[model samples]
Target: MTFFRAFCIERSAPATREALCGRFLSLDETALDAGDVLIRVECSSVNFKDALAATGRGKVVRRFPCVGGIDLAGTVLRSAAPRFAPGEKVIATGYELGVAHHGGYAERALLPGGWLLPLPASLSSQESMAIGTAGLTAAMAITRMEENGLKPERGPVLVTGASGGVGTLAIDMLAGRGYEVVALTAKAEQADWLRGLGASRVMLRSELPLDAFKPLDKGIWAGVIDNLGGATLAWALSTSKPTGVVASIGLAADSHLSASMMPFVLRGVSLLGIDSVYAGFSVRERAWARLAADLRPRHLASIMRIIPFEALPQVFGEFIAARATGRTVVQIARSGETEDMT
Candidate 1:
């Protein structure tokens, strides 16, 4: 195709304070950024970062007029890179996608082959996008924590931002691995749903005085997969057991961290910052393999929703408002193209 539709995020001219503008535009194939692989995008997923960039809510977009979807799965159409060839199913995420570089939100994406991975055989395009960057981050976090001596029998693992995509997937993965998964969320209403996703206990954020963090609270958590930063992160650290591993994934709440060093110095708690973007190929491959096998979320069908590509603009608000749940996969393949990617 010479031209295709893409939801592009553009900057609104030169302003004192730059504002991002996002819209659907028909873009020429030549307009795409240079890359070795050309992919016919079948599916993409909306992430918290996508919402921030598309809506201009957060300072996420590093470059202007970029197509915005951090995670994409599709069939490759052309390749200059020796590792990939035409007609192979593949997935791409992170590494400047949706922010600095043109990303998935288009019918076709031209990206460096090094930024892509063979789509796991067990995961279809739809299912892969359903997992997307969020699931990948969760899997990476779990893998990192486990490598740091976190085990199912260590103790309970706390997942902050529990109603969101990463938190939900982490809960499912942790519980499936026989760990006691405790979900911490502001939405008390989703307690039962979180439980269904394998959260052994649901802790409401309102119950905790996040700002009133003690230097050392009763050591409760053996591991923590923290999505929200700021006070929530501080509380998690302060309450962690000796040598507990905390994987800091996202800064949805606030970026600044203010807490006593008691958790780290006194108890030897380990805080691991998960950088899914710019992660080396070997690390991602190992995580993806586990994602397809044991770390794969068991309640995916129950928590995921497939939406038509046109409906993409409508859901950004839900994410910006912190009302989004689980995962939302965008079906990007046009009509007449195979919709049953699974």
Candidate 2:
């Protein structure tokens, strides 16, 4: 039997107050659930949700003894599914990965073919991880807004949580498309970094006046890609131009929405729900194609930090504390090894 590295978390079997702890462990191939495609993981990236699952901060993983990485770019080692062949470069995200199933934190991954997307020609495995789930969500937000008649000439787009992965990438993508981007962040220190990613202006979260918001305010935003929910999201809806689309992708602020229909009914604003996880296969393909094309980040080197897999345990806290900048890619296996599996 062959053994591979896997980061696993387990709680007490009888259930106690003892916190769940994750550690590096060697796992057999058969230990992973049955799936159509077997992949030699070239790399994986950390997401905020991965931290929640690995650290047990949130009930992200519904099962125990699970690996915690929600996104991976790899080369297929074997395939029982007709859509893929061995040695094919691929990417997988969302779905049951890292939750109900063993995930990309391992050197190997087994997944249903339905969950796989061929890596775009424009992006290498490292670049894909640098984007990961967060980037995918950002791209989806843009695509949804564009399909609903958003144009670069409309006006400026607002992105909340501008220093985080989604916000940074969204700013880059929107700005790359010639749209003026307004980045909202609490990290004043990162204002220059946000602007460097193409934010035309940076607004501090503290300055938003969350406590004193009207149902409708100035129609400053042509569109809003909101990573912060609660007051920020409500504020986005209230202040967007009439017929504007607001893509709500994150709930880091607060999930509850305490607002009236004045924004939707009177202002004619549309709130788009962008769900990268379990998005239809067509939608996934379109988003990846866009990422490879117009939405590919020109400043990927500035947005990525590559680390070895062993560092995952310590880095989860960075995401939990919202201290993580841009994206962190985990090198699980070298490219040569990923492409040539014995």
Candidate 3:
């Protein structure tokens, strides 16, 4: 309404030097970045990328003085595109937002019209942020698995990084699809929580490699939805059944893979890399629709942690240190003027 509050990382000192500061600032409509549509952001989420941008840990933000949030949902306050109008609820994520562009860590956000998605009928702004890009990746992994001939009737499905956002959501989605899902995580304390998300069995990291993996060990898993790459991915590949599909999404552990081609050639294993960013509108829409329908979480509140804007810095630290799990939704605009919003 008046001055907007935003959490941003601004460039400072010598231009050649890469000094940055993260803090809160007051801004007006003029300060909002330019885009085809202006939205009053109701909620933005704390994704790993957002945490990296906010904390300046990784090379996630290419521009200086940019807001730090990768996912946002809100009511459009103004629109230049024919596809959207004032007072329409929309969601924006991926593409260049929060990276090359000023993103959604503010009370108001200006986003390219093409990046906006009408909120699925089944989800609210809060729920959309809870799902965010992580859910999209999980949904994409599932869709890709089915396309690659992964049927529930075949056997059990394995989910790596079972405590993380994508892993948790994938477990829920895979179990919801009638597949027997086994979760793999290092934290044994969260076993109950993982099971609540639909994991039939939870295995700690030591349980894996299960006595050293060869080129192809056993055909235990019909499908694998993996978030951690590197050795974890290699293990999944080596243990997967013949003609098994493994969807690789995130690389929180390590980026490089040290695996032989024996699994690929001998087992006919297929490794699909899931990219949520820059996914086409049709694919994104289908993913959200599946999210609203079958992939909808039975324990949404259980999988999400909501914090006010003031808690961003702490949460960002938790994310970077790998101390946080599940999804975290940031309440940006607490008092959105959405009474008349359609």
The best candidate in terms of TM-score? 2
Q: Model 3 Cα displacement at 34 (Å)?
A: 2.7
Every candidate's lDDT? 0.91, 0.88, 0.85
Writing each residue's lDDT as its tens digit, candidate 3 over 1-342 gives 558888878654322222235788888878777788988888888888877776666677888878778899998888898999998889988998888777888888888898999999789999999899999899998998999999999899999888888888888888888999999998999999999989999999877763477867767888998888888888888988889999999898889888879889988999998899999999999999999998887777999999988877677767767777899999887653444432
* Candidate 3 accuracy as TM-score: 0.94
TM-score: the better of candidates 1 and 2: 2
- What are the models' TM-scores? 0.95, 0.96, 0.94
In order of TM-score, best first, we have 2, 1, 3
**Number of backbone collisions per candidate, in order?**
0, 0, 0
lDDT of 1 by residue, 287-331 (tens): 999999999889999879999999998888788888899999999
Model 1, residue pairs in steric clash: none
